[model samples]
Target: MEPEWIQAMQEELQQFKLNNVWELVKRPDPRKHNIIGTKWIYCNKQDEHGQVVRNKARLVAQGYTQVERIDFDETFAPVARIEAIRILPDIMHSVCMCARFQAAPKESHHLVVKRILRYLAYTPTLGLWYPKGSEFDLVGFSNANYAGDKVDRKSRSGTCHFLGRSLVCWSSKKQNCVSLSTAESE
Candidate 1:
């Protein structure tokens, strides 16, 4: 293996150990339970000019093999959709999830992930900008797309909260209930 890749893996293992992420225990009885597997995911971290800056290695649990109630119950993590201006973080998250489902991801997914990386390279300094002494008023804007998802025909809603001139929070998510009309979708 490449030295950087080895170093990245070592760093990941070190972090896990430092954080006390898991414990070594005897294998569970096959008749009573299942043991979830894990794997290492590797990637190259790039700089603004698209040059490789570092190597990244992540250890992820095989979530697919996990039984819903037996291995784990629920997730508290929040989900968000990609936006035009704030694209990298959300798309990166989506791509990571897609990668987990497939043993080998498709070419299209790779292209999408690469495109997001390129975009990030082009806009390395892009981020929320709040001028000093700006007003502190809180404001929010929200919108919805009616039956946006073609497969399921479900509506999507998004909202952004701003404190004065800076964005404080934002989210875009699919609606749980079917909307009869545009008004209802909003």
Candidate 2:
């Protein structure tokens, strides 16, 4: 492995230690018990200009090899994306696009997600605040994309609700039925 990759691996191990990622246990008999395996996923961190910033190494489980009920009862990967809570229109668009392709995400999608996370980490004040004296004025706005998804030709619906000038709620979901025209989509 390259030096950068080694450094990244070390950092990841450090994080695992700091976060209490695992418990030390006696080695299980290979013939009696199925021991889970893990793999290292490596990626190149990049900047907006497409320049390589650093290396990122993620230690992930080879969960596909494990039996569903015997090896694990239930499986869930919990991730917290802070940008989803904020009402930044640009960020939401990027986040929504990333989520749409999360199953088989490309390198570009990964870069976009990294950018969104970095933005949220540095500049953290783009948040909605409900003040006590703020007048109650509920306003809602909605829009739809006609045949937004090129694959299925499914239209997308988005809505934003605001109390006075602060945005409170927002949602974007793909329409169930494909609409031939924009008028039908609305």
- What is the TM-score of each predicted model, taking all chains together? 0.35, 0.36
Candidate 2 local lDDT, 39-121, one digit each (tens): 98888888899999988887777765543422223333432222222223565456656876878989998898999898678
Note the clash tally of each candidate. Answer: 0, 0
- Lowest summed lDDT window (length 10), candidate 1: 78-87
Best by TM-score: 2
lDDT, candidate 1, equals 0.69
Candidate 1 wrong stretches, greater than 4 Å: 64-186
- Per-residue C-alpha lDDT of model 1 across residues 31-103, encoded as one tens digit per residue: 8997778988888878899999988887777865544432233444321111111223454345445655477
lDDT of 2: 0.72
Error of 1 at 109 (Å): 40
Local distance difference test, per candidate? 0.69, 0.72
72, model 1: CA deviation in Å?
12
